[model samples]
Each structure stands twice: as C-alpha cells, then as structure tokens.
Target: MAKVRRYSSPYLSDIAGGKVVVSCQRCGLERRYDSAAMIERAGDVSLPELRIMIARAEGCPRADNVYRDRCELGYDPECWNGTRPKPTDVP
Candidate 1:
C-alpha cells in the first residue's frame, strides 16, 4: 500500500494586514493590498484566507503568480547571495 501526502490550504487567519503583497519574479510586477480594503474586510476574515480565496477564484495560486520566487513565502534569491540583481548606488 502507498501513502499519499495531502497539502493543506492556506487560510486568511494565518496572515496579517500589510503582510500580503503580489510580486512576479519574471516580470517584476509588485503590488500591495489597499489598506482601506483590508480594514473594511477585517471583521470576519483573515487577509491570508481572503488572498487564497481570491487566488482560487482567479484560477491561479497566489504562490504561483504573486509569490513565485525562492518559495511561497517570497524570499528573494538575491537576498541569499543567489544569481540576481544586487542593490547598487547609481550616480
């Protein structure tokens, strides 16, 4: 008999406001949620849960389009000394 590993879905209650943002490593499109909207929807739902729902509704995983980088948590590879752009001072 073989066992299968099941993955659990992320919920809104698992994240906080001002913590969720969308960024694409391929296109470098970064976007953040509106603070006003977060406040308005903070009564009965969590930001992470809402994001997951919206991702599903949009037919994509937030981790795929929004946080597709080193990991689902959005850790930039360059930050860890990987082959990416490094911060530099421009004249």
Candidate 2:
C-alpha cells in the first residue's frame, strides 16, 4: 500500500497513489482521496494545486444546508509546509 503522510506540500505522485485526509471547517466532513479518479479527470497535479482546483467539489458537507462547503485539507495550513516552500517548490 502507498504511504500517507501528514506534514506539508505534497507532490502529484502523493495524491496519485496515497490518500489525502480532508475535512471541512464548517461541517467537519472527513474523507480519503480517490487518486485514480482524480488522475483520470485532472491528469497529474500536485496535492496543494489539486486542493485549490478540485480538492473538494462534492457539494455541501452534511447536505443540511446549514453551512456552505468550506472543504479544506485538514493537515495543510496555507502554502507553507511547516517551513515555507522554496521558489522552486512554487510551480
């Protein structure tokens, strides 16, 4: 099985093989990522980029219409992976 890590900036390969744990701030929806489907849809893109583009597009978290979908990667906070990404890291 592929390794799942929780720290910072993940490469395209990370999401491509392993799983990404994501949760919503408003509703607290947690789930793993479907790498195969993602690759099929968006080709090869980094996890951070993937989050920004297509991370959570599954609509409302609870479907109660209480709060809008504010889905975000539970582990990642902003762009910095504990330490800021170098210029080369920012594609």
Candidate 3:
C-alpha cells in the first residue's frame, strides 16, 4: 500500500488571543496552533510561508474549501498514519 500523507492550511488568522486556527486537509481536522510555538520553530520565515512548507512537508496540497466535498470522501492527499506517542514514549 502507498504511504499516507498529512497536510495543514497556510492562511492563518487569530481566532483568539495566543491561538491560531489551523485546518488539516488530510483529516479535515480543525485545531488550534500556538502562534508563539510556531514562530519559535520557524525562525525568520513568515507564518504563511511556514504553513505552506509544513503542509507540503506533510504531503497536503494548498487548497481551499472548494475541495471540501472531495475531502469528505477521503480523497485528501494528506492522510494520517494513525499512530500516537504514549506518555512513556515521550523524551
């Protein structure tokens, strides 16, 4: 089987203070990302650019809500591998 990929949205806005909303095309999951944490991880890169890079790195295409129908049927290019790290596994 082919490997599944994951992706995130590039356009980020402040839904609330200190937290930014992020959309995952692969899983259709909307989650909040810590802006400060992201800035620290992507020093020198703009937020939008960093979002795009992160999405592509995870194998998701930069698209809009126009593809929502397709994404519902699981046609998303970015799919998760269904794995999670346990507390004991954390370094």
Candidate 4:
C-alpha cells in the first residue's frame, strides 16, 4: 500500500502537486496557476488571499472593495479537496 497526500486546505503548498485552479461565477472567468511559482513569488498564501490577489491583478471590479468581495473565486471540482474559502474569508 502507498500513502497518499491530501490537499484539504487552500494553501499554495498544499495544492502544489495538484492543479491550482480558480473560477469566478460573476466574472465568467477561470484561471489556472502554477503553485510552485506562486509560492516562490508570494510565499504560501491561502486561497482567500490568492483570490484577492488574482482579482486585483486581473482587474476585477470587486478587488477595490474586498470587504464586499464580489470576486467569487471558487476551486474547480477537478482539484477540489475541501470547501473553498469565500471571497470575504480573506484575512
């Protein structure tokens, strides 16, 4: 038998081996990211944080007011392991 790893969190390092994908229902956009690369650039940020960062980088209207958090970033089912943090879940 072999041990298996699970990515039950939203941290970049946790999902590094699997696909790091996020999609926005409101914006109608989906994006895939290189987890290793992102970790190098931004350390191991949580999905909520990453959502805000992506929203800002991609010019999402809700990026300006993260408290309202209209970015709606959700993990694609193909790589989902746990309940994805909502936009307002950012720290």
Q: In terms of TM-score, which candidate is strongest?
A: 4
Span of 10 residues, lowest total lDDT, candidate 4: 2-11
- Candidate 4 achieves a global lDDT of 0.69
TM-score quality measure for candidate 3: 0.37
Cα RMSD of predicted structure 1: 10.6
Shift of residue 91 alpha carbon in model 4, Å: 39
lDDT, candidate 2, at 27? 58
Q: Which stretches of candidate 3 lie over 4 Å from their true place?
A: 1-17, 24-27, 61-91
Give the alpha carbon lDDT tens digit for every residue of 19-42 in model 1: 345445643544445434654565
Ordered from best to worst TM-score, the candidate numbers read 4, 2, 3, 1
Residue pairs with colliding backbones in model 3 are: 5-79
Residue pairs clashing, model 4: none
> Which parts of model 2 are misplaced by more than 4 Å?
1-8, 60-72, 75-91
Model 1: pairs clashing at backbone N, Cα or C within 3 Å: 11-49, 12-48, 12-49
TM-score for all models, in order of appearance? 0.32, 0.44, 0.37, 0.65
**Ordering by lDDT:** 4, 2, 3, 1
Candidate 2: minimum summed lDDT over ten consecutive residues — where?
75-84
Clashing pairs in 2: none
Which runs in model 1 stand beyond 4 Å of their true positions? Answer: 1-7, 34-91
Candidate lDDT (C-alpha), each? 0.42, 0.52, 0.42, 0.69
TM-score of candidate 4 to 2 decimals: 0.65
